[model samples]
Every structure is written in C-alpha cells, then in structure tokens.
Target chain A: MPIIVNLDVMMAKRKISSNELADIVGITAANLSVLKTGKAKAIRFSTLDKICEALDCQPGDILEWQNPAEKT
Target chain B: MWNKHRSLKLSRILVLCFSVMIFMMTFFVPFVADWYEDVSDGMGLIGGSVYVPMMVTLYVCEGLAVWAVAELHILLKNISKGEVFIERNTRCLRCISWACLLAGGVFGVMALWRFLLFLPAFFAVMFGLIMRVLKNVFEQAVEIKSENDFTI
Candidate 1:
C-alpha cells in the first residue's frame, strides 16, 4: 500500500459529491467508497479513464506514492 | 439425473445406508461369531476363543467408521447448501482422515493376532491417505478463495 489514493482530496478540490461523481463515472457509490478508502487492490485502466474524465483531472492528481517511513 | 446435486444426494444416501448397516451389524456380533464358528470350523481359520477378540476389533473399527460417516454427513450437507471450499469442510475432511487412519491402525494391529484382517487394514489406510490428500487440496482451495474475496 505504498501507493495512496488522493480521491477525497481531488473530489474536494473539484467540489463534487461522492454520489454525483459515482454517477458521472458510471460506477456504484459503494465501489467509489472502496476506491476512496483505499480498500481496492486494483483499479482497471477503463475505470481510471472514466474517473479521470468525470473529475476533469489526471491520474497523477488522484494517486500518490509516499514512503511509509516518511511523515507527510 | 446426472447433475452434481443429484450425484451428491446419491452419495449421501449411500453413506447413510452404509452407516446404518454398520450400526445394525455391531449389534449382531454374537450371531456373526456363531456363523463364523460354523463356517470356519472346516477351514480351521480361527478358534472359538478368537471370536471375542475379533468382535472387539470389529466394534472399535466400526465406531471409528461411524464417526467418520457422521463427518461425511456434515460435509455433504454443507456441499448441498453451496458452501464448498470452506474451513468447516476442511475440518470435516481432517476428522474423517484421522478416523480412517485410527480404524486402519486398529485393524492392522488386529492382523498381527489374526492374519485374515490384513486386507481391510490395507484398504482403510489407503483410503485414509487419499482423504488426507483431499483435505490438503481443500485447504489450499480455501486459501485461494479467501484471497480472491478480499482482493476487491
């Protein structure tokens, strides 16, 4: 889990609700919650594409890599 | 007629019937002894005193087989309910394998006393080993299934 999902931060930056983003991205809100909470083991490229298109952002904006030993 | 459910049901029924037969036979030990005395007198296979020891060995092995069949009943019920590759089934298989091994060991020891018991002892131990292998497979399958479930 060195890779982190910054979905919440990006969603906040764009001022979009979870339900609205899920609808626009054509995924269930529960799956969106799993992604947001970093419970998903993988993200398909198609799903990532839909998410990026819906949020008007790049994949890099929503994902980040941080060393567990480093304090953010 | 050839469906998995039907096949499983048939297997369950057969196991249940065999269990019941063993249960009934345990009660007929004295009669079996009399019959054996009559039949084996010509062949001189076993003497009258040996029947008691044979009865004891048979009863102990039957007890183990009965317990194993009960485990099979639980396993079949779970499979029928669509609960394959679970820990409970794995435990059931382990119990059955141990029961078979114990029964086989008892019969094998009895064979030292009576040479006629060798065949059953050999088959029982072989079946037990097979069951042990099956239990290992189920254990691996359960691990893979749990990992798959958690992947999402």
Candidate 2:
C-alpha cells in the first residue's frame, strides 16, 4: 500500500490513453486501470518492463513509495 | 467412471432421504418406545422409565441433524458450482460443526443417566472435530485466494 503507482501521471505526460498503453503492453485495460488506481498488490517485472518500454520511461518514474504519515 | 459432480448429487439425494426418514421417525417416537418396552419383558420397566428422556434426546438430536444436513446440502451446492474455498462454504461448515457439538452435548448429558448414549455422543464429537478442521482449512484457502487475486 505504501508503494504508489504514478502510471496515470506518466500516461498523461506521454499523451497516451489507457487503452493504447494496455494494447502496447499486451495487457487488458482493466489491469491497466488496476495499476493506475494503485489497487494492484504487486506488479510483475515483465509487465513493468512492457509498461516502461511502451511509455519510454524508467520504473522509478512510474512508481513511488510515500509513507502516509510523512506526507505532511 | 464416477465424477465429483455425480458423487455430490448422490450425497444430496442421500441427505434428502435421511431427512425424510428423520421426519417419519419423529411421528413414530411414542409407538416405537411402546414397542421397545413390549419386546423385552424383564426390561419393560427400564424402557418405560427412560421413555421421556429418550424422546427428548431423539428429538433434539434429530433437529440438529436436520440443520447439519441442510448446511451440508448448501455446502455441496456451492462446491458443485466450483465455488470452493469461499467464505460462505466455511460458514456452512462452521454451522454444521456447531450443530454436531450441540447434539453431542445433548447426548453426553443423557449419557450421565444412561450409558448407552455414550456411543452417539462420542461419534458426534469426532464428527464435529473433523468439520471444524475442514472449516479452518476453507478459511485459510479463502484468505490465500484473496491475496492472490489482489497481486496483480
């Protein structure tokens, strides 16, 4: 839960839609939605690799660890 | 070759038949107790004396038996639908286990008065333990399945 997915930010910066990114990464849009919404427990490295390859970004650019208590 | 579906269907039918048999026995309790006294002349007094306790014991056990069987039927229905390891099935198993324990407890108290009740009391305790174990297994499985589902 502390691991946050910034996928939507990256997608917006890259001007890519969820459906398009999902197609390029060979995953369903529902899974992309799960990743974007931070509802996924853990993302597979292969899927991460595909997402980075499609978005032209590093994993660090798409993922962040922010402690809720430290947000202030 | 017999399959799991067929086996479950058979179990459902068997439970239905047992429920019917229990229902019939409820109506025949008084007659059966009277006949039991008549069958053994020397033990007639003992039979007559135990009649009320016997009826109470049988009715209570039979009521629990109906409840347990209904729980089993629902559990089997869910399993046949490929819904094993769910919380509902675990709940059904829990209900069946408690029913067995309560029925066993009834017979156990009756055993204090008549030693003949010990046999059923022991059987119910063992059955309840088995069902409790099964419920625990199902609860664990459901937990694991949810964790797996969330790991995207």
Tell me the TM-score of each prediction against the true structure: 0.72, 0.83
How accurate locally is residue B52 in candidate 1, as Cα lDDT from 0 to 100? Answer: 69
Candidate 1: chain B TM-score against the reference chain B:
0.88
Which whole-number lDDT from 0 to 100 does residue B125 have in model 1? 91
| Residue-wise C-alpha lDDT for candidate 2, range A1-72, written one tens digit per residue | 679899999999999999999999998889889889988887889999999999999999999999989977
Write candidate 2's Cα lDDT for B72-142 as tens digits. Answer: 88988888899987899999999999999998899887676566677889999999999999889989999
Model 2, C-alpha of B27: deviation from truth (Å): 1.7
DockQ for each numbered candidate: 0.28, 0.59
Question: Candidate 1 on B87-142: residue-level lDDT in tens?
Answer: 99999999999998898888777666556677788898999999999999999999
DockQ of 1: 0.28
Clashes of 2: 0
Misplaced by over 4 Å in model 1 are: A1-72, B33-48
Over the full model, what C-alpha lDDT does candidate 2 score relative to the true structure? 0.84
Count of residue pairs whose backbone atoms collide, per candidate: 0, 0
Compute the interface RMSD for each candidate structure: 2.9, 1.4
